[model samples]
Target: MFKKIAVPVLLAVSGVAAAAEGTTTTGVDLTPLTNSIDFSTVLVAIMAVAASLVTLYAGVAGVRWVLRTVKSA
Candidate 1:
């Protein structure tokens, strides 16, 4: 069923791509722009992940401590 629609679309796209002019990449330099970009979001995400792990560890420890105390009593 999908082949009926996909074949013609694929052939059309290929034909257009084949007929495209000046599809060459020459002298493209984005070094200066990329170098100045701040990557603080990735650091913040890592800190958030650390916070979640700490919270999970604390919850598990508290539950285990309460269970131990109850069992001892």
Candidate 2:
């Protein structure tokens, strides 16, 4: 009984190990995929400009608010 159960388990484990080792080599080139229109730089520049505008607007609004408050006082 032990021999029967152990033999099938060992065979299943060996089959799984062999299947894991059988890797197919890919022949596809990925240079074109990597070189195609990188947008990270443009995205970063746009994000920087947007952030600067938001900061400038915030500064201007803060100054205006302070001026109005001082004037009211």
Candidate 3:
């Protein structure tokens, strides 16, 4: 009898408490100075990744062009 009456009230209170105290961590806090990396190395890596992406895009475009031509012929 008491449990039936208290359960809903307790659930409602817990929900409100969780809403009030939402401890969400903002942004990624990776490594936190555990590993040291050179700025130039980072830049070079970024450049390499960008070049790879462009090369991939060109390859895909070339394949699409070849497929379209073959289909048309």
Q: Number of the top candidate by lDDT? A: 2
How well is each residue in 1-73 modelled by candidate 3, as lDDT tens digits?
Answer: 9999899999999999999798666856767564565588889999999999999999999999999999999
**Candidate 3 positional error at 73, Å:** 0.1
lDDT of 1 by residue, 1-73 (tens): 8999999999999988887764666777899999998889989999999999999999999999999999999
TM-score of 1: 0.52
TM-score of each: 0.52, 0.52, 0.49
TM-score of 3: 0.49
Error of 2 at 11 (Å): 81
- Model 3: runs farther than 4 Å from truth? 1-37
Task: Give the lowest summed-lDDT range of ten residues in model 1.
Answer: 19-28
Ranking by TM-score: 1, 2, 3
Across 1-73, the per-residue lDDT of candidate 2 in tens digits comes to: 9999999999999999999798668767889997998899999999999999999999999999999999999
| Candidate 1 accuracy as lDDT | 0.93
lDDT ranking, high to low: 2, 1, 3
Q: What C-alpha lDDT values do all the predictions have?
A: 0.93, 0.95, 0.90
lDDT, residue 62, candidate 1 = 100
